[model samples]
Target: MQIDLAMLFLTELQVGSERLYKIKRKGTSLNLRYEIDGEIHRRSYLSGLSWRAILLFALTEGKAVTVHEMDQPGRYRKLFPNTLLRRLHWYARPNANFPPVARFYDPNGKAVMLLTRSRVCGHAVDALHNLAHSGPVFQPLWISDIMALRPMLGLDLVRDETFSAAMPISAYLEAAAMMGRIVEEPEFPGLSLTGNPRRLVTPPSSKAGRSIFDQASRENPALEKLRDRTIYADYSLTI
Candidate 1:
């Protein structure tokens, strides 16, 4: 929820996350934290997808969804080891249960699991893993955003403009295999929603590259309306 000096006093716990943070007010901003390791971790209740909290509200009221990730950790790199650098990953759910059962990767790409069935919503975990792990899924639009990040990470194996949008990862993988290692480390995808997100952009500032999902956020309309809102926190952005 948006807060400002003129807003009335309110207190609440946020939803759609692994942890429930008691929402706190600071000056004109709404912030929350307690027993956390550091001050860098800042979270928004309905932050991930604009309507995520809405969806969660539905789930709490008996709306059934296969996604437990509504509360899954926001950052992917943090969950993996350091050796796993740039990743070109995807999952197809072909069955009515698994809509697109397709397995694919690049010659140089080391397969990584974006969807963790073990973590799928408590009730759906067994069903998701029923097809030998074919229940994992992410949206196609997210793939497009990851493709857009290729240029920034120096994974210029193939220009996105040079390939059909449907098959952009082929170039990304071909490039990574052919020596696309501009970054030795990964950045948190959470920065896209954090107050400090400029590094995720390209040019001389390439160190902040592994943010595979930032590209999709660029086209978000809800974020577009925040032009007049100012972010006051300095977020470190990790799970």
Candidate 2:
């Protein structure tokens, strides 16, 4: 059977909640790890397409389904009925009240997933971070704004991007800038920074790259200020 590779990876996950995964690079290998059923599972990839397919699968399936039980090789197609797929597609459309599934790289150049929620309620970032060894990043401004407006509308929200259009360019810039800063630092202790360092690295000149300097300037105006801080203070160098 022709398998949609994207659907296969995601359905293999142990957990069902919509969460992000981090892909690390070790020399020529891509190291992937995420929490499934509260246990950590790791795999290695040699191709970018393979890694992307894994992530796509996770987002599409949102739960684990064994291959033997599936009719199609692709987990996503097997798990999602036609009706659910249509609903997911409709909700995922640009204007729907769903969080867009976005990919980004950390300073160390690892591939990461950014997920948005439908409701304004608080999410468990620590849980997500623990699953991937990289902490989850929250877009609080967007979440807060959505929470404020949710009471006024009678919409059954599944994600908060419904009002993303109402957000200004500045808001997006600020969110991008914050992500840049967070990706540089090694906040999680379980994950190792040493490896091939290129297999899962971020783009050299993206929003995360720009935030390196911007964050440094704001946190440490003078280079002298960082002297007493932790070695990981400068996110650009460590990640």
Candidate 3:
């Protein structure tokens, strides 16, 4: 059996270069470890990038790795491709719901699609669970219905004029972190990465409220400026 320390040594050999190596099966499962330097990190293949990349970055650099999961088809194709999957797994199955969707809010608390839905999605929840016990506060924002926002303009979702409803950023992220820690109930027999996968599908807005962006702009001129800058900035310019 390949112990955690041995995996770390193997990963150290592959730093700066990507290589594929098989883990000696321990029992029913294989402990996939990505090691760099003397530090070794282990993750389930099911947990995906957050467990693989984010944790490595955190352990090596002492920085928080920001993870976002998407559920959009258009964006999913652009971000993660089948070629990458082949590199990760001997055989990979694309989830029907690809690009696992996720919503991000600006300072004012409007939801915008950060990731689109696709057939091959990565698991952020499981990654959070592996890293959560280490001390970083996990944050989760429950969007009332992610499907409704699919057609909505990304900009409109971030603003208060169109979508005023939003959860407290800290509260959402922390909850998400906690949710990631939950273990699946064997009796349920379903795929749930974090707390409730359905939370990602819900809508955050109601008929009576304004968009969170508008409210933010009203309260903080700096945020309005940032939004304007983000909206109007040319992509061709190099920072």
Candidate 4:
């Protein structure tokens, strides 16, 4: 990969950019982890901007990639020409479910997004949501998924949010790093890349990057802001 392309991918992904919030009521508190996850999933799936970044990187590199719409069609506009992509059947989503994802496969490897529904669209789908994204399993899953691909390019075309959502993650990275697959590119200052099927890490510039200080990502509601001088949006625990 071109150094600039890699650097651009790292920067554009904005690994540590998400500013999360916690809410406190006058007396009771609200549980928004699932809600937060919903919002995150909704954005990740519906937002064309996110997919554009991923596809753009691959197209720029002239790498052949596939995006499984998972039966949802016309959701992601074609970023490149017809010859570049091989799409599966595009299906309709009548109810418009939350956490719908398109599976991505590129020369680097694939990111298998598990949703509530089965591959063939089973009833009462099983969800990969609600499981702690930053918890024990999710972060390591990224490394394992990439490793299994054994990509030809020594990279994994992962989105920036993958790094962010799984923030404060490292043990798996150290393992990948041990293989000399992970390192910082001198060409791009502050770039920390874990290659051999890349292990996504928050670059130094990310606001949510490794830090000792406590960081708050958002503001409390106007009502809550007025009532309690002490109350601020609590950082979400599950998110």
> What TM-score, computed on C-alpha atoms, does each candidate reach?
0.18, 0.21, 0.17, 0.19
Tens-place lDDT per residue, model 3, 139-162, is 211121221122221221331222
Please write out the lDDT profile of model 2 over residues 9-120, one tens digit for every residue.
Answer: 1121111132212222233433345443355655554433354344334433564422121111332233223443344334322222233332222233332333322211
Off by over 4 Å in 1: 1-48, 66-111, 114-239
- Positional deviation of residue 6's Cα in model 1 after best superposition, in angstroms: 31
Candidate 2 vs candidate 4: the TM-score winner is 2
Q: Compared with the true structure, what per-residue lDDT tens digits does model 1 show for residues 1-239?
A: 21110010111111112111212222222122211122233333322222323333444455544321212242222222122221111221111121212222222443221221111122111100011122121211121112212222212112112111222222222222233221111222221222221211111111111121133226443433433322111112121
Candidate 1 lDDT score relative to the true structure: 0.21
Report every candidate's CA lDDT: 0.21, 0.27, 0.26, 0.23
Task: Using lDDT as the measure, name the better of candidate 1 and candidate 3.
Answer: 3
Best by lDDT: 2
Please state the error at residue 183 of candidate 2 in Å.
22
lDDT of 3 at 222: 53
Between 3 and 4, whose lDDT is larger? Answer: 3
lDDT for residue 227 in candidate 2, whole number 0-100: 23
Off by over 4 Å in 3: 1-65, 68-78, 81-210, 226-232, 236-239
Q: What ranking of all candidate models by lDDT puts the best one first?
A: 2, 3, 4, 1
Q: What's the number of clashes in each of the models?
A: 9, 11, 39, 5
lDDT of 2 at 104: 26
TM-score of 2: 0.21
